[model samples]
Target: MSLSTTSLRSPRVVVIGAGVGGLAAAALLARQGLDVRVIERGQQPGGKLSQLAVGPSLLDAGPTVLTMRWVFDALFERLGQSLDEQLSLRPCAVLARHAWGPEERLDLLADLEASVTAMADFAGPAQGQRYLAFCERAKEIYDTLEQPFLRSQRPTPWSLAWRVGMSRLPQLARISPFRTLWQELGRYFPDPRLRQLFGRYATYCGSSPFDAPATLMLVAHVEREAVWQIEGGMHRLAQSLAALCQRQGVQISYGREAREILLRQGRVCGVALDQDAPLQADAVLFNGDVDALRQGLLGQPLRQAMGGRPLTSARRSLSAVTWHLQAEVGGFPLSHHNVFFSDPADEGYRREFADIAAGRLPAAPSVYVCAQDRTGDPMPRHSGQAERLMCLVNAPATADARPLTEEELLLCQAQMFARLTQAGLKISPSVHPLQRTSPQDFARRFPATGGALYGQASRGWRASFQRPASTTRVPGLYLAGGSVHPGPGLPMAALSGQLAAEQICAALRSTRRWQPVAMPGGMSMR
Candidate 1:
């Protein structure tokens, strides 16, 4: 059962979970001539990025907007392919619209000068200049940290120190890593409206701007770099990646849940499926929740260690309750993405995160609406003609025993509709609930404790290192995705997969005695 270095067998890589991370890792290893097998519990690939059928309209369940296009470009380039050849991406002129109250709207345009001018007109001239300055600082931080920390797997303190030292500490300090994002913005802009507007970026990683480090301002820079949407839907990107993996000679098994990480002696081994069959491998990369692995997918002896001192302590991020609506409305002044802010922004945010931490729901929650088919397309209606809408509200990630009652749903729906109507959206042609994913449902779907979208909350200075590394105490085990280093979002998760692949490749290369088995069409045998 031992896969010794001297053995003629090719390295077998078992990647659990068909998420972006798992798929990316499998594709990378397959390109390197490794025998890679992907096992997913779901009926199809793409964890959260999968598509959902709502009547005839196709809606993307996760990550509508795509940033960091270079990441995907690089991944495809590595495999001797171009992303353009596989899929088409359309650049959004208007990124998103933010509303403070009734008759108040601010559109974040793709053009920097236009956005700045809009801010000046809406808020003040000083706020506009401050935003420009913020963008510059964000670009600097992104450029300085991109290669050394973000692209690499297991960024040690020494590596970070060296990179920071090389960049000159003064420039690094200018990014304002000490203060919270909100605190830093407040320093630059006197207007409270401007601060609240920019503060919303913290939720990009499921964090509160009041608590996340000012370094997170890089999110704005990243977005400005390029904001795009897939031609058909975001899920098409996942489908393309999965297709690329299959074409590269990687084997994918759907609806096969990995029940255990079968270890031989104290080293790496393989995996056992729920069907009671063993799939052997030289290395095992888990793209599922790290907490699940630590909880013992193997059962028994594995269970003891799974609960043992966690490698990293994590604070769950805020969960959301999303309502997918199908309705008929004329003259809906909204793009693909829109946000409606409730009164007293700080009060609402505090109630959602802080009050929830103290065990309570927010008094007034900020609601976000994403209208996918606002352009008005004909055909495919439940009863008659209808459009698709995704309404989300920021809620606490507490696992309360109380289930959502029908009355609660009606009340929330009424409040959301009122807010939408007040914000200049005509919503009087009968709206039907196509689907509703609550905090409990998110928890069940993703198995994120308390349904926290982001793996851990980024609060204190130590929070950066709070993320677990790719490798664990168990020899062959490795982690990838939102839970691991570099954190969440589509781009970060993709980077995690690349990092894990690098680690696995490096580990195999170190064993010079092992030779890859040659097969036809650039494939390898295990």
Candidate 2:
């Protein structure tokens, strides 16, 4: 798996971006006795694991749930540290709440049996049994992919098949990579509402269920595994990682942008900063969106590093419009995570994707609201007090080319709140301090992305395999982040960092040829 030639001196590695991926890579490299430095443009760490201000409250503006904790545990364990000692996390009793209308609601509990019972009551005994069977299928798919696909380096279809071995090809085929998630859901649930609810998992990767492969059902199994809530917002997890990096002798330079990646004789040698002199390094790991390099935002020399690949707008992932506010809630008791579905007349979530595909805001988009101040309790800890809430709706990743107008944005906002009211969740109009973020804002925050939350849209089965590997065409340069191999989500992003670190360490530790031992499906050396 190693690529670089052995060097006599200790290697100096510079990571661009203080995201979870970058921070994770830096920590592992530092632990390996390498001199590691992280460059971040923001005032603080945590790229998308970020927060927004509302008076004295800092609401989580990016990812709200934490899953696949084992990823962090392994990272800390490798660094000779403990993840539990670093951050406090409480497992959620109620996974999420879904509402189809004022009187129709369902809560998926952490307990499988309890969730089945609840589903039976919501739909019917037969549908409930179907749900139970669906859970089993999801688990089967997850079990099959966890070791061979997720934990390994970038793998093509041929490599994945070879790793699975000839005996298990049927199991791989059953994962249903050829069908769309939305279509597959119809087989298990005759109830349209149930189909809509489960199909929504595709959005986790910033994709539409109608287009994303059915293989995405693994997301359901991931949540079923467990969802933990950070004691302080999710941003605290980022800060904790940054703290760990510093303790490991990794220097973090905040407020300094990486203007360009320095290359010498067709290989990476260092990073050029916008505010300071270039940093000389034996290797460079980029944890930001890959599009930034392809678009020449990081200098023209590395623009063709991706082989002048064209990332068309049609291929971009979904973006969102969000509202962060502190408001008093009344009807429809809240859970840690809640989703309010659009009426069936709105075409059962299909129109939402179609509108976005046409570069138009959805007229009746479903809404996801995160009650930051609530646990499993029916009411907020401080009853009647203004609770921190973040409401979001799916939108097109067209801010850079087809930005929404002020009038269009207002209409979109109005429709979002209306959907909430229809579900019987009421927020006091006298709410103090509400902030809104559009796709345009996101595009500016993460350049050359067009505001895509996930690196690229998981449009088909091949899409997952299409993500770039940790190693780049330029030697000594690597990639990490949601956009790279393994896919998006807090844990997946961290795993991508681990993959990059493993490759860098292997490459630097020796010049002897080594077979990839991380997993059977791991990438072979070039």
Candidate 3:
């Protein structure tokens, strides 16, 4: 349950990218008495978790909601830090507002009973019952996977089964890892709208509902457990964690890019930076997309470790076209989180999936709007001047050699706002200042990613297991971030960091070079 090793000097650990995963690993390893240094190319530490500015507006550029908060609690608790003390979080009363068309609107609430009541009123009594049952099923799947697949680092189904023990094998069927999430929803809700509603869970990992495994249903339970609105922006959480890392003696270097992963006899020894001299380290934890490692972006030598054939565009996840606007609100009352679904809902997703699959932007796409001003209440519009608002529409990955043209984007933008208006929501473009970020922009910012938002797409049934693991074949190299193991989203990304840290601790312990160290997530090494 503890790690022990003999060493006179502290082992220097270098983390690539200051994304949540890198920051988490750096913080935990530093706490364990390792000399940890984080390298980032950007001005801030959040990576994709950070905020962006469009003229006068500071908007959340990436993820908006914070769910599975316990993952963060466990992380900070390891360092004897309090998350509540460090950051201000407002629990979302209404998780998110969903609109299908002019007459159909639904709100998923933080309170499960309230959501069920809303569903009853929106759909029918039968749907309300089905929703309650779906919640139970979702929780069951979540409970079944929590300790084994999510928390533990296991490579194959056999390893996962071994960790779960023989008794828990039947529960695999309980989680229904065999079916697509969209197909599985048909069993719970007969309403196509409700099916698409719950099936939306697949998008949580940046995969299409028709393709992502039903195991993603756990996302529903994850959301129901907690959804907090970070007071300033989601990036504030990253800033807070970076500050804590500094307090723990972890050195953070920004505006410096990692050019190549220095290797010694097929094991990681250090990293070469773009702006500075090479940094020598006992081990390296990479927090960027594994694509960087495979594409030889770091170095040609590291490509073999990435495994598999070259990643094609077909393997990427759905990207998005985003709008960050400082505007005034009107029409339907805005909530903290609002999702405007495409009317003739089937028409929206069908075209979207087909277009993205064919590597083209969807003409009509579902839009997710985050009204930053309306966190707990609808802000009174004074002269229609409100703070920042973020509008996001799912798009194909940045696969085209040429960017999504302003012409193409203009068309998508027209559909985006149009869907909002048809769904009882309205925003005046003339009154607002907007910044558009196409998938091409995302790809440019995060290199080698086709602007695929949530790491790799979780496509086939085996994809859940196919993601790169924390412990790789390379002895001193490790992987973290949403793309690895436990899968995407804020909490999942943090867990990936914890897992990488645990592996590093275990590796150091086995080498007999460090003192006995107890791992995170209540895990202990023998």
Candidate 4:
């Protein structure tokens, strides 16, 4: 059921930011026969889902993993497009490889039984059995929340509980919102190595395992479902989305920054772009961090629109320091996704988070290295050529206030490389260009965020409920991004955008000029 384009007055929607959230919203709204325009400050599409130039190769600068691909598939399908037709995707067999020392390494394969057998070989029969049990529990948690929480429009605790019903209260309790992720992992893995490995899931949401809720374990299940390697790069997904939006009649203006969301009579009326005339719209969808509104980065009106609330630094999520390079490497075999862990014997894992919590860089941080070239191709494909790699470590989100000094970053780099060397992987120095992005760099890239990558940290159980929903106090202004509900990551952000679009269409249904029709399964243009 799509809205009639022949209607006298079509709803005009302006989406600020060309991030996945903004792109997704623009695409959907345009498909519904509404006039949609997307404005991005950057020259290209993809906000965090971007690429960096490293010498002759382009390395993925942000997220490398692509999970929950159905989110995109369904989105494209609704837009009368096929994701497979638009982009090439290769399934990844090896989910990731984790290393603690030179010889001590574990690989989690895409196959569940294979991962279980590998765990058994690495830890023992008991550990293997525990891994199986953990998988079951993780699956249960994912299934339990998939409909009531993830797919729902920013459900509160009470609403979510009601959706779960009285009969499933036991299942709700099993989610273990009261306990931290670190504390919950103990029930599944006695070995500290396994605990550390599993606890790393918290970092997916830019959170510390010691503070994040046990519900984060569902991330393990999400990964187990599937991981795909996009041909070219993950940024290709952004390109495809942008292309689709244009085809759907969405006007996407690159290198255009939205300075303010204009309001008339306390309702969104237009958007004021940097150094340009304002764009009149019936509704506005903001795809950047909600904190930007609270902090008055966009405009003073946005602060008042947000009711003058401030997001504390303590609630901010983890930032990252990344080194993207195209380099020759040797020693330990590299997988597409790899993790070099800090020594657990010396409590380095706990200390890492504690140091970040105190706004200090960890002495020895756990590093994540993404071998972009190795994802879909055979090892022989890059026999002699340089591999594009992105090495990242979690850091404090205080770079906006106190940027990391060159001396401090140099020392941190040395320490990070030392950990890589200890894991038996070595990089050959070359004339190839390397891009080092500090938390301050991220802060500059995305305004109003002190380099907090995934919005506010998923610290307490209430944190999920605290994220602002699509509908805000402002009548015609909505929020959609990683900072909002359904949590962070590419798929989650896309869902947030879809939710905002739905809300916009539903609200506009009350107007006399346009009547957008929604079908049982989706929205359509009549």
What is the TM-score (0 to 1) of candidate 3? 0.94
User: How does model 1 fare in lDDT?
Assistant: 0.73
> In model 3, which runs have C-alpha deviations exceeding 4 angstroms?
1-7, 345-348, 376-384, 400-402, 430-432, 516-526
| Local accuracy by lDDT, each model | 0.73, 0.87, 0.81, 0.87
User: Candidate order by lDDT, highest to lowest?
Assistant: 4, 2, 3, 1
Give per-residue lDDT, candidate 4, residue 338.
92
Evaluation by TM-score, superior candidate among 3 and 4:
4
Model 3 pairs in collision: 3-516, 3-517, 5-512, 5-513, 5-514, 6-512
- TM-scores of the candidates are 0.91, 0.95, 0.94, 0.96
lDDT of 1 at 42: 89
| TM-score, candidate number 2 | 0.95
Q: Write the per-residue lDDT of candidate 1 for residues 1-526, one digit (tens) a residue.
A: 4445567667889999999988988898888878899998888777878766666566777777899999898888876688899888877777778886656888888889988998888877776888888788888978766776677655665667676786476666676767898898777767666676677788877778888988888888888887887877888888888898999899999888888887667666778898957998888998976766555545445545444442232366767777775677644466677787766445554455565454344446567877775421112123325667778876566643444556655666677777677666776433344777777787676653566777777775556666888777766677898878898888889888888887777677777745433433322121
Task: Evaluate residue 376 in candidate 3 and report its C-alpha lDDT on the 0 to 100 scale.
Answer: 38
**402-466, model 4: which lDDT tens digit per residue?**
88899989888998899999999999756876789999999999998999999989987898798
- Could you tell me the lDDT of residue 268 within candidate 1? 60
- How would you encode candidate 2's per-residue C-alpha lDDT over 1-526 as one tens digit per residue? 1135455556788999999999999987877667889999988889999989988789999999899999888887767778889889888888899998889999988899989999899888887789888999999899888888898988889999888889988889999999999999999988888888998999999999999999999999999899999999899999999998998899999999999998777788788888768998888999999989888888888886556574778899999999999898888888989999987664757888899999889999899999998885433365777888999999999988899899998999999999999999998743466899999999998999998899899998899899889988888889999989888899999999989988887777565432223433232222
- Report model 4's TM-score to 2 decimal places: 0.96
Candidate order by decreasing TM-score = 4, 2, 3, 1
Task: Please list all clashing residue pairs in model 2, or write none if there are none.
Answer: none
